[model samples]
Target: MCAMKYGLLFFVTLMATNLVSEADGDLMSMIDYRYFRCVMKREWKCPDSEINFFMYTPEHPRKHFIDPRYPKLLHDFGWDPMRKNVLIIHGFNGTYSKSPMTFIRDAYLSRKDYNVFMVDWSELTRFPCYLSALSNMKKAAQCTAQLYSAITQAGALAKMITCVGHSLGAHICGMISNHLTEKQYKIVGLDPGRPLVSAYGSRQFRLGRDDAHVVHVLHTNAGFLGESGLVGHADFCFNGGQKQPGCKGHIMRIARCSHFMSSCYFAASVRRSRRLVGIPCDTSCPKERGYWGINPQRRAVVLGDDVPDGSRGMFCISFENTEDCPFD
Candidate 1:
């Protein structure tokens, strides 16, 4: 009787294994082969120590670490409830100390007396681990949501806060809403990561129009490293949304350079609002010869920080001179 029981247990375990394999096969058919290879292979749950928040004020340009568990530490670290808050999240392989997203932080600080928070989850989403990084985004977003909650509870108005993110960081900003009772006011998604995300990620896992009152997406390297077409309430396709003129290299190298340029362009716009203007386009970046023929009747909209909250549509803009474009 004991032998029979052991045999039955072994058979049950084999069936369970087969069931998991069948489910995995179905998922693989839905996503890219590269993503299938790494999908949930090494899922990660980031600890509070691995995710960190830093606050920067105009008076104190230096960043001060703030723990969400200790909400009072926000005031101790020079967080001002009266001032508008800007939360900047970095992409894969990025840290609060240094990254292209820092340009946006610097721009906000220089332009106005605002409280800036940098969300760093670099240890969980380090380079060469894109798959694991994708898996860890939800945990990172959950931890950051706690920081956002603490800020609002400490008297910072939700309407006065804006979340700015680049690449995978963009999706993290959106996912924060999943943990909140109310939605965010504004979200600037700079070149939201494409790859496996754009193809397989659902709205809950990616940046969407409903994530915030105003979701502005700027595409600098669309269809390659960045998500193409409209992914937000307002989508701006700079230089056709595929490649920036100033970025010079082979295809992949240029795409990387273009991806980084989104932050640079946003920084420039914060400093000089309404300068980088765009006009309504049919979801496609217009060629140089065809750009002039676009309907002049369409009202032009400003790109970046000052974009009106109610704005919606796909817009395209090109630099008459490459020198005007910002490059990192």
Candidate 2:
């Protein structure tokens, strides 16, 4: 009887093991699809903690970049009969065609007053701040080119335009300023993450007065950069920084999977431009107080091919942008 019981337990264990193996196989396949490109893989690793270890080092954009998930974001946005211009950008690990962006799409669609557009960049996950700042510089230039083409095509005539970015998307906000024409602009950067400043120091990157008129950076983490120093984005602030009053943590937040309902805040603010949305600004930090990095002249972060020769980006190459680029 004892031997029979032992044999029965062993049989059950083997069956369980087989089932787990099958489940793991399914998971692994999904992983392949999920981490489709370097940009997605890298930027998604969040909270900047040791726990977020790099699963695989992604190949550069020129390498194995694949399909851009944000199709609507890249579309030529020309309103019927024309309206004001508005460009919306996504941050790290974000796709304009995906989740939060879906909410964004709906938000803009609801408001017919603005000629809505989106900037689908090189995968945000692929370029670290240091690398992204440099490589994305040109991509930024090209995207702005596209936006202008879009603006021209739509034939929209308005006083000024506005650009909104989230986290990594905020970096694109800076990039647009660097590459585009100097227009009276309104850039709202929500929870702009520190552009993955490298070991040497933080990069001197910011949306200059040249890009947008009043560029506001709403900060969440009170790390190195205080309330000042963010050039281009003249209005540097915080979402009350860290744990603010109105936010209701992860699950309960308005929409999407983001820890904070950042997009909702972004949309709310975008809807009510010119007027203060009152979305919690950290006025506590003394104004005009921002710490500088090591080499201010050269941005502290290197990006794209400029991602320091030695430094390897976190995600591996899955495909190339040219292979799947939905461009003319």
Candidate 3:
């Protein structure tokens, strides 16, 4: 009987393994199609703690590197102190080399003579270790805050600096903004990562609404990678902040689709002049189901790079699968 039971168990395990292996290709292709080139490799080794900054300007619109050690490196990089500065922070398991990060930098460089900085902390954010990456986020935020201070002390205006962070990177921006005394430096959090941040409610570690002068959060994958609760001055939920339009198939793709849409919409907003129309709702309203309401008296506002000053409160936004111009 023992021999028979052992053989049966081995057979069951083999079958399960074979099934998973067979479906692996389909799952990966679906994920790639919806995520727009995501690398889901398992990186077990701990990455080094290093932050890289890629700067881009109108004069040298291509791309340039800046050392955080030398605060005056901006001058050598030909940074324009007059133009607005945008610092983009990528999420867990992501680097500045990723399409979203580069796309954002290019979009800003193409639109105006703004100084776009890409913050790469991939060393500490390797894949399959999201918990480790979440813990290291505080360190990343500390490094970023130091860099921000150094840059301001050298020449750049603190008010002109706008930090844009996606997923876990968004929370890092919030932590950085919290440490900075300058209240005018806005933070645009693109679907701040939900899992670990919400699990630990300690205010010292999580991103709050008043972390910056104006904390604007865009929730595209709430309850998944994004925190469902409103954690910003203005929280905009796109497509009810759950399953997005473009993503279908596997469960993983569904979760990632909306989470990534936050960055996609923000990137598109940089080059496109047309803004999205958002409908306002009561504070007690459910954000995930915000689209099925009727409140015409409330004025609609843009939710991205073109958002006007003093656009406060929560709102619901809808967009087409391809772009933000077309509303649902």
Candidate 4:
């Protein structure tokens, strides 16, 4: 009788301990990723080893799109219907639950007034740090078809399509960059991984002379590209990349940081910041005013002589304030 009692107590203690020590993957509350990015602020802090552990695991992402409520908000705020699109891709370790595209879709849905998208071809996925070689790049590039497909699904008339990629996600973004747009697309690479540019080669990461006018890489955690790459941005801005406060850097938040989520922080901020408008100019008019998203309240857009006077179309001005700015 005593032995049976001891066994029962032991089993109860075991269950209690298991309940108290939850694994990172425990499905309880939805992770507020934006609230816990790699920066070290009061809201987002984690041990270094956890950051590393988080990157190696693969989370199959559920496919997602803009939430329905977004359009209503855009209409409420008086946004233009004819505007461009922006696609945000997450890096290796940054996926939502099981779906790599979850937060990406969340980003699009975050600002429903504008055309936004998430790009994923998990079938061709490679290890996060493996961008040091092109050995698997050929297989990884197969995702271009999906890339083209998603762009078509978003809108064929979109004047410009910008690709924002981080870390390995940037490499994945680079893989399809060649075909992500109809004419030329814009690309924003944030702390692009070291192996990414080299493993994929420069051809994999490019912004055409006529390709949407610009490409930028925020070099905070850039292990390879020098400080100049950060400086070279026409609108180059730093995230503090993997190390910004509020969001823990990968090196520090290794447990929570993944190749996918690291760059995603920067991508999310940039993706939601632009102000989009439409201008109905005659086809004969040059594609003068490039599409941009301005808060129309907190921020301003000052076009210069250098502002892509490139041959494009005229833009109609209509304010589409980014709904509840993601960075906020």
Top-lDDT candidate index: 1
> Which candidate has the highest TM-score of all?
1
CA displacement after TM-score superposition, residue 286 of candidate 1 (Å): 8.3
Number of clashing residue pairs, candidate 2? 29
lDDT value for candidate 4? 0.36
Q: What's model 2's TM-score?
A: 0.50
Clashes of 3: 0
Error of 3 at 69 (Å): 3.1
What's the best-to-worst order under lDDT? Answer: 1, 3, 2, 4
lDDT of each: 0.76, 0.38, 0.69, 0.36
lDDT of 3 by residue, 84-139 (tens): 88889998767887656676777788877588888888876654335556667777
Output the lDDT of residue 133, model 3: 65
Q: How do the residues 1-328 of candidate 1 rate in per-residue lDDT, one tens digit apiece?
A: 9999977754542332222121123323433444323323233332377788889998888989887877777888778878999889988767767646777888889876689999988787654446667778898898899989888978888998989999889999999999899999889998888777865688899999999988999998887778887889888888877778777755555767777888888888886743898887766532344453355666788776567788877888778435444332
Better of 1 and 3 by TM-score: 1
Query: If both were scored by lDDT, which would come out higher, candidate 2 or candidate 4?
Result: 2
TM-score (C-alpha) between model 3 and the true structure: 0.79
Model 2 stretches with alpha carbons more than 4 Å out: 1-78, 122-134, 158-160, 195-204, 208-210, 222-239, 244-260, 271-328
